[model samples]
Target: MAEWLNILLRSIGLFILVLLFARLMGKRQTSRMTFFDLITVIVIGVLTAAISLNLVNVLANGLIALAVWVFAPIGMYYLSIKSKMIRDIVQGRETVLVNHGKVLEDKLMEVRYTPEDLLSQLRKKNVFNFADVEFAIMEPSGEVSVLLKKDKQPITAKTLGVSVGHESVPQTVILDGVMMDEPLTAMGLNRQWLHTELEKIGVAPENVFIAQVDSAGQLYVDLFNDAIITPKPKTKDLLYVTLKKCQADCELYALGTKKKNAKKIYQESALELTEILDELEPLLKK
Candidate 1:
């Protein structure tokens, strides 16, 4: 009974100590952690476990071991921040795998990354064709950043010389059929306005699973049963949808046009569609 009591007290004390040390170490996530950061975490964990299990003078020895393991990494982290050279030495620099459509074979060998591994990473970034890539960099955190060739990149409104409005982050107004008063207040909205907006879509506040108001004052609602996901119409989305329909129709009309008069009609429709597309492009960019 006495031995069990000692174990219980020691476990509680060590748990609190470890928690405090974790908080002191800052908020660096496991995914973004460097090699040294990972090693420090593993060593601290092992030390804490070993100390907790040992019976002879466990409290004093465990505290000393835990402090040393935790503080050393904290000190090194500070030193790395103070010096760029130290930071590079501690966390290795990013490696360029591909440059201007040419693969850096020497750098790949240095990083010990196989051609298959590079191809796999490229595929994850949606670049299946090697020729489409302008730059491919392997970050120190083992994630790859890809840049596609200029000609292969998607066209934007700026390319068509169209003006686009600013976009704001969507704010949650309701969650799980409950109105979020704070978020609604932050968005400069009241319950009366929310009820009115919900009424417009034929959805009651209690029926909503989740609702968000976008920067354009468009309300998007998801029902509890998920039977409906209706979003308030925005001018930009309407124009883009119309533009796509026009393009599809133009293609069909071009294929069916057999007479000279029909061909002239198709050409006129195509020109009008192009003008509509130019106006719609800016909205799609946003």
Candidate 2:
């Protein structure tokens, strides 16, 4: 009976220790879990359980040890934020993987990553060919950040040599089954205007999945019922056209690997964007 009781008490102590320690560590540390963090957690749990069955001051000692470990990271994080030196020590700086279509082998070695590993990360981003990548970065948190070759980049206003300011996201004036009064008022639209728009779209307020008005005064209406919604344009034709455009443009602007030029890959994307806009424009106008 005494042995059983001791086991029970130890189990309870282990559970409590893990709960408290886990809570102290932020969600990110646990969620994006690393090998070192997992091992540290296992060790703490085992140590707390072992001590729980021993001397009278076992609980107090365990708590104190847990507290020290818990706050130590917080203190380090605090110093890291305040001092550049400390920050470097805690979290290493970002490492560049590629520059100007050239692979930086030395940087890869510094990060202890092999060619296969780097390629694997790139493939995850849908970039299978190395020559297509102008820049790739492996952040300190083990996440990869990539910048495609200039020619592979989107034809944004700046890229097309056109000057344009920032574009704001559309405001949701109606959500679920209710109207957003604040957004309605801010956009110079009211309940009457919303009703008129819904009527034009052949959908009632109760039948809408979502409805919004953008800064350009374009109204986007999506209906909850498929029966009420207009039939969508054929995606197969649009997809083929878009893909061809992307491939062609990608080849023409081909900056990366010689195997697949920028013009050859993104040609289809151009056609698809144009087709999609044509279909959506009429719907919004209504």
Candidate 3:
């Protein structure tokens, strides 16, 4: 084979081989890679380059070395999974940077991270003041996990003792002016309902840039024309409110009516409507 053709063939074969080996090695994002992982990746790249450029005289020798590098970590990963001791040794234990609003100077030194480094990482996590941090630990991946003081933490529904409806993943029912039938059907909706929603909003499907239906059954739309502000549909909320009003009106009529039969009918109607509202509340509010 020609020199250039030989190099090209070698590169192509190695690329596919490495890709297969990489998948077998398992998936780990570059950002989340440990120091050990980074070194392994560098060595693999160097070996691949050497083999591709004919720096290694024996292709078989290069392949063996590549195999060792690729499989070693995979074995370690499995071992690590089965044993906590192996995992701690391989990945290294996370160092505590802060405990109960106090920065550990000794732990910082052990991790070879300065106070500024901790502050920088904390800032990235939206935590500016170290005093507010309840605990901060640097993981083996070098990412800092932060916990704020109880009082410093943001108030959630649970914290406030508020009863909130569950929210599922929002479905993208429309993308780039095209209706996505799968997502609509997944949400127990149809194209007819989508069309009706579009009509109610006074915007054509073609004009919509993107549309998503949240768990609350609210259709959120972004129009292609930014100049036009499309109003969000609150059909579920309106229906809920309308039902509540009707129930209230029925109760009022029951109290006001002089005839016993009319009063009994009104009371029964109100009670039935209240039951319906109770049943539908979960679906309406998310």
Candidate 4:
């Protein structure tokens, strides 16, 4: 009975100590384990087990072993932040495996990485074709970072020479059929405005599962019942299209009209409309 009681007491005490040690180690160890981290984890596990099972005759010795494994890595990690040379020696340098869609066979062989292993890592990153890869490098954590060729990359506003507006993260104003006033207040909205929006869409506040208000003053609502469809907003995109068409119509009128008064009126309208569109372009297009 005394032997069983001792074992139980030891297990509880060691379990608590392990939790405290893990907290002190920080989250980097689990996020991306380096070569040294693996060794430290293994040694700590053995020491924890020895302490719990009373396999180590001296309790102090087992604890000392645990302390070294936990704290040494922390100290090295802090030193690594201050010194780049120390970091390179500890974590090793990243190796470039591919340059301009061509695999560097020498680098692969130096790292003992087979072609099959490279392909496996590339596939994990969703890069099926080697020809599409412009650059592929192996990180110290063994994770592969891939970059596609310039032509293979997705189109963006910068490539097309267009300016875009920046939108803030949408705030959840309604959740679980309850109106959250704090988010609505933060977004410069009120319950009356929300009620009006819900009424326009023919939806009740009770039916909503989640509702968010974006920077463009657009309300997005997800209801509990998926079968019912809600009407889409025709504010930004539709308004911009309509204004463009009106401007084009004015330009055509100015060209076709025989009367000088009508021609001047149409031309003036087109110029004024163009100025207005230029001001609103960033907000609508983005």
Taking all chains together, each candidate's TM-score versus the true structure is 0.75, 0.61, 0.90, 0.79
**Candidate 4, residues 1-286: lDDT per residue as tens digits?**
5877888999999899999989999988799987778888889998898888889999998888889888888898889999999898778789999998999999999888999999998899888888889999988887889999999887998989887788899999899999999999999999999999999899999999999898887888999999998877656888799999999999999999999999999999999999989978988876
Better of 1 and 4 by lDDT: 4
Which stretches of model 3 miss by more than 4 angstroms? Answer: 29-31, 268-286
Give the alpha carbon lDDT tens digit for every residue of 1-286 in model 3: 8978888999999999998988887777255788778888999999999999989999999999998988998888889999999999777888889988889999999999988998999999999888899999999999999999999999986898656677799999999999999999999999999999899989999999999998877899999999999886788889999999999999999999999999999999999999998878867764
Where is the poorest 10-residue window by lDDT in model 2?
A: 231-240
Stretches of candidate 1 exceeding 4 Å from the true structure? 55-57, 228-286
After TM-score superposition, the amount by which residue 272's alpha carbon in candidate 3 deviates from its true location, in angstroms, is 6.5
Looking at candidate 1, the ten consecutive residues that score lowest on lDDT are 50-59
Model 2 lDDT per residue over 126-191, tens place: 999999999998876777898998888768755665444334678898788678899988888899
RMSD of each: 9.1, 14.5, 2.4, 3.8
Q: Give me candidate 1's TM-score against the actual structure.
A: 0.75
Model 4 has a clash total of 0
Q: After superposition, how far is residue 70 of candidate 1 from its true place, in Å?
A: 2.0
Backbone N/Cα/C clashes per model: 0, 31, 0, 0
> 107 in model 2: Cα distance from truth in Å?
3.3
TM-score: the better of candidates 3 and 4: 3
